[model samples]
Target: MFGPDKCRSTDKVHFILQHKNPKTGKFVDHHLKFAPSVPYDKLSHVYTAILKPGNELQILVDGEEKRKANFLSADYFEPAFIPPKTIPDPDDKKAEDWDERDKISDSDAVKPDDWDEDAPMEIEDAEACEAAPGCGEWKRPMKRNPEYKGKWHSPLIDNPNYKGIWKTQEIDNPDYFELDKPDFEPITAIGIEIWTMQDGILFDNILIASDEKMFAASASSDVLSDCQKKVFDVLYKVADIPFLEAYKNQIIGVIEKAEKQPILTIGVLVSIVVVVATAILRLLFGRKKPQVSCNVGETDAPGNSEENEKNDASAPHPRRSRRET
Candidate 1:
């Protein structure tokens, strides 16, 4: 069973490993929390958890181990390390009048004269004077009552009738079997089952091996690259075969229809041939001729040049004359 989904701190990714208890026919969960959190908004690097045979587990993030745990004793696991059948006096009843306080009130204390017994603790000081309007009388402040014995209680003492905490009696677990050597139980399948809040999660390179070395070799870059190539080939070629075949059939149908009407087919074929021939001719000799500049190596017309020179010589430039003067 999965642990709590939401309602927990968002800072951690919780992983729960559950095993069936043969004796109780109930599932026991082992939970692990890892942090420096999961990046859900973007592509997060792969995280790996390695659990070895000897109750040793390591959490790795991006190929580096973050935390390691060694379970030398069953105390690290719950239900396996059961509490004793009896425990120190959890049920020991305390006497109703038992008192644990070390201090007592002093009976000789007296109230001072300034203690106005009738005055209220809070009087209106709104007038901004030493005395407020309609609140001249100050109430006496409360103090520890001298006559109070502070709820008399008897000191704590050992209980003569203290019966200890009751625990589950130990018996042989029907499901537990002894193993000859330290080895992991055989895993028949490996799968991923997750509850995600958003979509578009991409899972790749699921690897399983006997140990870290095998996993490292199998999940190498070269291996993953080959796997990706295979996947791409299958998707583009194998998966698209039906659609491609249908496309080819459609073209064939069009050709067959055209063949039924020879005149129309011939006309279309002639048009296509013309278009193809024109395209080929254009490709072979498409270079545009270098344009001749209208004024290239050419002098101005005699009439315009003479007229311009006459105009320039005849025109009186007042600014030029002033500079010359």
Candidate 2:
């Protein structure tokens, strides 16, 4: 079984080996838990565990070795089936006068003569009224009192009676047994028991084979490499913009190049400034025509009167003229 160390924890991964103890006839567990070297969320990752012939264990993530140790070593794995070789002595007991304290209060401490325990922590400012004249009834602000002294306490000193920690002697256990190769059980069934708050956990391409070469062949697929290539291509496209392609490698590279050729750097900066200033000038003042205004009561000119008489001689009158009668 493989899972996390606890519920809702995605930071660690654990591999458990369950088998029936030959001596005790009860089922036991051996756990190997560690933090993953690569991210295990929002992306597919390959997890592999290999048990070698010499009781050695190896854990890998994305075909990279992360943790390796001996399965029987007490430093790496938790062997719950094995009993301790020596147990604490039941007959041993601590002495009555055993002092475990490291420090005690000093007995020679005394209070100073000028220390005032009853003094207030703050006092009203006496010169506030004189500083600001005609300010109505100005309630003076309070300042920290210089004469106030906090409660006194004696300093601590090392205790001479300390005898250090007490411990009991060990004895050999009667039920202790040793196993050189604990991986002797036959493969029958496999199961997984897990508790996690995360959703949409996927398990794919699970391979259980006796030969290590078969497992290696399955793990060497192009899934992870293809994903990494796609991410790099996206970043390349985003950096391929005008005036940025020259420094697409990194911003630090641009600074180093600018330091080497200061003349070129100044020319590029002046060009950018000129382009921006021209755009601003066109936006503020462009494509506008002058407007003309005329007075409503202005008199007509002499050319306008002759044109009006010619127009009246060619028009028909509304009333009959007296010359026709």
Candidate 3:
């Protein structure tokens, strides 16, 4: 079964190969999911799934192979379709004397006489006041005690009785069986099951046949190609008509109103022309005036001799006077 599915935010092509488990006598699904090369909703696309006699599988979109895998490969399928050859023996049990613990505490470890259990974990600094001057009535800070010994425990050692992990013996599976071509199945009827929040989900030209060449020929037929093209063309044309017609009507109405009011139309056109002309003239000929700067205590005009003498007396000593001195 191959179908379209939306997974979270992305659209995917979902494929399921169904087979009955030989051991359990129940049907199981081998799933393969991937994003389509082209959106199926946006355009018409041909999706194909092929299973060969050698158990080789291929998935194609628009005649281009997107995925290929062997049916028996564990990398492609989930819940692995094939049963294992060896099974854990149900009758086999672990030995009664099995020791699972890998490590044990030493029983002969003794506490040394120097090890003090009563010692404090931290001690206050005795020279704190001497180190910091004028730190009135100082509260000494605590530091970790170098000689402190914490609660003691014997070190761990490897257990001599350890037998590693216990396991049940293996036996040949009675239900296990192998098939040369696991892809073959008897077909009585075809069915499609779909669940969607959307409408207008279309399924067309569904083919179930063993002949690969026939399927390819049907997909590539000129009639089918033309039909798909026509459907797309008609849909787009119908969707565009309303908006296009509204624009056409507005243009026609403007022309009709202009014909009825020629003077008003001419006045509006003249105003628009004047505005455009003014902008262009400014852009071409507009220029800024050059700026002139004067010193803090000086004027641009030449002064009279009397004014010059007064200005010279009030000014600070010049660089020429300093050089001469």
Instruction: Write down the TM-score for model 2.
Output: 0.51
lDDT of each: 0.47, 0.63, 0.65
Candidate numbers, best lDDT first, in rank order:
3, 2, 1
lDDT of 3: 0.65
Please give, for residues 1-325, the per-residue lDDT of candidate 3 as tens digits.
7866664675767778788877777788877634354453433456788887667888877677888877776677774567668899999999899998999998888888898888899999765665676657767878889989898788889999999899888999887778555745787787878787765455657788888877676556412245444643443353345434433444344333333333234443444345445555666776655333324676534658687666666774455455448
Checking candidate 2 for backbone clashes, the offending pairs are: none
After aligning candidate 2 to the native by TM-score, how far in Å is the CA of 239 from where it should be?
27
Error of 3 at 172 (Å): 1.1
Give the root-mean-square deviation of each candidate in angstroms: 20.6, 20.1, 24.8
Q: Give the per-residue lDDT digits (tens) of candidate 1, residues 23-127.
A: 465666655533335543332244566777766666665466665654333444443422233444544555655554444444445555455455544544344
Error of 2 at 309 (Å): 80
Q: Estimate, for each residue in 205-239, the C-alpha lDDT of model 2 and write its tens digit.
A: 67778887776776655134554446434444544
Which pairs clash in model 1?
Answer: 119-138, 119-139, 120-139
